[model samples]
Target: MATTTRERLISLLSDTNEYKSGQKLSEVLGCSRTAVWKHIEELRKEGYIVEAVQKKGYRITTRPNNLIPGEIKHQLDTKKLGHEIHYEESVASTQEIAHQHALKGAPEGSIVIADEQTSGRGRLGRAWHSPKRSGVWMSVILRPNIPPQKAPQLTLLAAVSVVQGIEEVTGVDAQIKWPNDILIDGKKVVGILTELQAEADRVNSVIIGIGINVNTPIEAFPDDIATIATSLKIASGKEVERAYLVRAILEKMEKLYHLYLDHGFAPIKLLWEGSAASLGKRVRVRTITGELYGNAQGITEEGVLLVEDDEGTIHRVYSADIDIPRES
Candidate 1:
C-alpha cells in the first residue's frame, strides 16, 4: 500500500513547524485538498494538535514528545531495531502488543514502542513504572534460530547494548544489575522484559521489551519506587533526547544481535559478565517459592544464575527478583 495521506501530511508538517498553505500541501503531496483536509482531521483525531487557519493552511501545534512511530521513523538512521516500529500513545504493554504481532507472523525484526505502558511488566510479572513522555518503552521482535534454552542470553546481550548506548548518548556511567536491570549509581534506571514464542522445543521469536527511565523526575515516580528508580536526565544532569538514545541502542543491539547469530553466546556472555556488577558477590535473591541467600558465583551456560549457599550447594536460578548487592 502507498503511504497514507495522513503520513504524507505529517512528513510535510515535520519539515517545517510553520503553516504550509493547503493548496501548497496538496500540490506537494499530489493529492486533492479534500484529501489533505481529511488527513489533517485524522491526524488531529490521533492526538496531534494541528491548527487550521483561514490563510495559514496548517501547522503542527504540539507534538507528543516520544518515540512514536512516524516521528521515530522520521528521525531514525538505522538498518534495523526500529525499522518496523509500531508506536502507541497508551498501551497496556508493548510486550503484549509485540507478542500478538509475533504470533500473527510479523517480520523478524519488528518493534513496538509506546509513550506510556499502562501494564508494563518485567521478569516474573513485576510491575514496571512506565509514565508518559519520560522513558523509552519498546519491544523488539527477533526470530533467531537459536535453541529455546539459550534464549535468556539475549537479555544479557540487550543489557550490555543498553548500557553502551546510554553511556555513549547521555554520558552516564550506567551499570548492569545482575539478570537484567540497568542502574545508575545504585538505583534502577532501565528494566528489560523478554518474552518468547516457541513450539516443540524450537524457538520462533523473542520479544524483548525495554523500559528506560529517561526523563522522569524524582517526583514523577511513585513514593515506593522513586527512591530506587532513576532516569537518564537525573543521572546525566540534563535532559537526554529519547530518540538519540533509542537510535544508539538499536545500532549497538543490532551489531551484537548479528554477532550472536554468527558466533555463539560466548562473546556476548563475556561482555555481559564484565559490565555486570553482581557476579561473584554475596547477595539475597527471591524466587517464586522462597528466598535464597548465597554467593552469586556466576551464570551458567544457559543464562541461569549459579548461587552457592553456605553449605556449598550450588543452585541454578531460573528466575528471581535479586536485591542489589551491598559492597563488602
Candidate 2:
C-alpha cells in the first residue's frame, strides 16, 4: 500500500515529539514549503490540531475522532485486512462501495469505511442508525476459496471476532445472539451483515459489513430502537476509540478467517458457541415463512440455528430474527 502525501505528512508529524520545520517537512515530503503549509491547513480542516509556531513549524497535538484512512492505518497491525482502505466522510453504505470494488477484482482484505452512513441497512432491509463519527461503519472484501454455501459461516466468524474485539478493547463481555447481533447487557451494540458474490460453484468474493455502535450515547438512538439498542459508550461508561476498535476487529477477523480456512469451521464454531447468548434458552425465531417458538439449541456445523419446538421437532433456521424470552 503506497502512502499518500497526506499520510506521509501525518506520519512525519506523529512520529516525533518536537515540531517539524516547514523546510524540513518540504524536503522530506518532496513538496514546496507552500504545499506543506496547505497540507497542514487541510489537516486542520479535518479536525486535526496541528500546532504551528513562527520558528517551530508544526506538530499535531490532537487528531479527530473519525475513521479516516490515515487515522486507521497509522500503526495498524494487520497483514492484509486493512491494507487497502477506501474511506469516505459520508456514504449511503460501505457495502455498496465494497460490492463495486469486489466486482472490479479488489484484493482480499480491502475495506470500505465511512464516518457516516446516510442509508445504512441491516438484515431484512431494516434501517441501521449510523450517525456521523458515532460508530464503526465499514465493509471488508474477502475472496475466499470456499463453496458459496459455506459463506454464512463467515458471518459467525465475524461475530466471534467482534465479540472478542469488543471485550479486548472495552472489557465489556459482549455476547452473540443467533445469526448476527452482538449484545452487551442484553442490548445490541453491534450488527453484522455478510453478502456474497459467487458463481455456481466458485466463490468470487464475500463482503462483510460490520456496524458497531462505539461512542454513541444512549440518547442518540432513535425512539423506536432506544430501548433495545445500546452503544459501547453506554455499556462501558467510557468513550471507546472507534479507530482502535476497527483495527482490533480487523486483526481478529484476519486471524479467525485464516483459522477457518486452514482448520475448518469446527474451531470457529466452538469459539462462537462459547460467547453465544441465546443458546440453552427459550426463544422465538421469526423467519420469512412464519414464527417458531422453541428452545434455543446449538448451531449446526454449517452455522444454521437448530431450534427444537414443542413435540420434539427440530427446525433448521437459515436466517431469522431470534428473540430470547426472559425468565419468569
Candidate 3:
C-alpha cells in the first residue's frame, strides 16, 4: 500500500513534538515549500489544528474528532481490514456503498465509512440514527471462504470485535446484547448489522456495518431512544477520539478475522460469550412467528441463540428480537 503525501504529512507531524520548518518539510516530502503550505492548508480544512510560529514553522496541536482517512491510516496498524478505505463526509448508507463496491470486485477488507448516514439501517430494516460526526458509521467488506450456513458467525465475530475495540480505546467495559447490540451500563451504545453476498453455496462478500455512539451527547439522541441510548463520551465522561477508536476496531477486526480463517468460529464464539450480557438470564425472544420465554443458555456453533424454556425445551432461535428482563 502506497502512502499518500497527506498521510505522510500527518505521520511526520505526529511523530514529533517539535515544530518542523516549511522548507524542511518540503525537503523531506519532495515538494516545493508552496506545495507544503497548500498541504498544511488542506489539513486545516480537514479540522486539524496546525500551530504556525514565525521561526518555528508548523506543528499539529490537535486533530479533529472525525474519521479522516489519512489520520486513521496514519495510525492504523492492520494487515488488510482497513488498507482500502472509502470515506465520505455524509452518505445514505455505507452498507449500500459497500455492496456496490463488492459487486465491482472490491477486495476483502475494503471498507466504506462515513461521518453521517442518512439512511443507515440495522437488522430487520430498522433505521440507525447517525448524526453528523457523532458516531462510528462504517461497513467492512469480508470475503470469507465459509459456507453460507456459517455466515451468521461473522455477526458474532463483529460484536466481539466491537466490544474489545471499545474497551481497548475508551477503557469502557462494553458488553454484547445477544446477536447485535453493544451496551454499557445497561444501555445501548453500539449496533452491528451483517449483510452477505453469496452464490450457490460459496460466500462472496460479507458487509458488516458497525455503528458506535462515540462522542454524541445524551441530549442528541431522539426522544424515543434518549433513555435507552448512550454514548462513549457519556459513559467515560470525556470526548472519545473517533480516529483512534476506528483504528483500534480495524486492527482488532483484522486480527480476529485472520484467527477465524486459520482456525474456526470456536475461538470467536468463546470471546463473544465472555462479553455476552444476556446469557444465563431469563428472557423473551420475539420471532416473526411468535414469542418464547426462556433462560438464555448460550450460542451454538452456527451462531444460533439457545434458549431453554420453562419446560426444559432448548429452542434454537435463528433470528429474533430478545428482551432480557431487568429483574433477571
Candidate 4:
C-alpha cells in the first residue's frame, strides 16, 4: 500500500534524528514544498512537537500523546497482533465490535479500539466509566485452539501483560488482584473482562476487553468510585502517553500469548502469582450464590481462585468481586 503524504512526511521526519531540507523532502515525495509545510502543521496539530529552523528542515522533537492508529502502528513490534485495527471515535463497546469480527472469522489478534466507550462493560455488566480521550478502551480478538473451559486463564494472562506494560512505560509498580484487576497503591487502575464464543466442547473466539485509566484525572471519577479508583497520571504525578502504552501492551501480550501456546499456562501463572496483591491476605469475595470470607491462598491450573474459609474449607471461585485487604 502506498503511504499517504502525511504518513510519508511523518516517516521521513521520524526516521532520522537530523532534519531533512524541504527541497529534499519535496523531491522524494514528488510534491511541492508547500505541501510538506502543510503536513508539518498537521503533525503539530496531532500533538507532535515539530521543530522548524531557518537552516534545518522539520524534525520531530517529541511523539504524540494521542492513540491515533498511525502513531501507534509506526514502530509497533508485534507480528500478527494488531496487524488489523478497527479504530472508532466513540462506541458502546469495543467488545461488541470485536465479537462481530470474530464471528466473521477475523484472524487471531485482531483488535478493536475506541477513543471513548459510552457503555463500557466490566465484570458482571458493571458500567466502566470510559470518557473520551482519557483511557484505553479496547478489545482484542483471539482464536486460540484451546477448550472453552480453560478460557478463564486468558484473563489472568492479560492482567500480567497489562501490569508489565504499565511498569515498563511509567515505572509504576502495578499489582494484580485475584482474577483480573490491576492495582497501584491499593487502588484499581485497570480492569479486564473476557467473553467467549464457543460450543459445547470447542472454542470459536475469545474477546478480551481491557480498560486502563491512563491519563484520567482524579476528579473525573464519580463519587461512588473516587476513593477506590485511580489512574497512572494521578499516581505518577505525570501524564502517561497513551500511544506508547498501547504499543507496549500489544508487544507484551504477543510475547505472553506465544509463551502460553508453546509451554501451557505454567509460566504465565507464575508471573501472575508474583504480581498478585491479594495473595496470602484476608479477602471477601461476593459470588452469585453467596459470599465467601477467607484467605486467598492461590489460583488453580484453570485460573480459579482457592480461598480457605474460617471453617478450614476450601472454595473454588470461578467468578466474583474481591475486596482487597484494608490497610492497618
Q: Which candidate number has the best lDDT?
A: 2
Off by over 4 Å in 3: none
The C-alpha lDDT values of all candidates are: 0.84, 0.92, 0.91, 0.89
lDDT of candidate 2 over 1-328, digit per residue (tens) = 6678998898889855799999999999999999999999999999999988899888999888878888788878888999899999899999999999999989999999998999999999999999998999999999999999999999999999999889999999999998999998889999999999999998999999999999998889999999999999988999988888988999999999999999999999999999999988989999888999999889999999999998889999988899987676
Candidate 1's C-alpha runs over 4 A off are 1-64, 308-315
State which candidate has the highest TM-score.
3
Clashing pairs in 4: none
How far residue 87's Cα lies from its native spot in candidate 3, in Å, is: 0.9
For model 3 the local lDDT of residue 107 reads 85
Query: Against the true structure, candidate 1 has what lDDT?
Result: 0.84
Tell me the lDDT of model 1 at 45. Answer: 71
Model 4 per-residue lDDT tens digits across residues 222-283: 99999999999998999998878988999999999999999999999999999999999999
Better of 3 and 4 by lDDT: 3
> Candidate 4's error at 156, in angstroms?
0.5
lDDT of 1 by residue, 1-328 (tens): 1244555677778745578999999999898988888888877776778877898878887665557566656555566667677878789999999999999998876888888989999887889989888899999999998888888899999999999999899878887877889988889999997888997688999999999999999999999987888899998889887867888898889999988989888888888888876788787989879999998888876788888999999999888878856565
* Candidate 2: C-alpha lDDT: 0.92
Superposed by TM-score, candidate 4 places the C-alpha of residue 232 at a distance from the truth, in angstroms, of: 0.5
Q: Count of backbone clashes for each model? A: 0, 0, 0, 0
lDDT of 3 by residue, 91-207 (tens): 999999999999999988888999999998989999999999999999999999998889889999999988888999889999899889999988999999999999889999999
The model with the greater lDDT, 1 or 3, is 3
Which whole-number lDDT from 0 to 100 does residue 289 have in model 2? Answer: 88
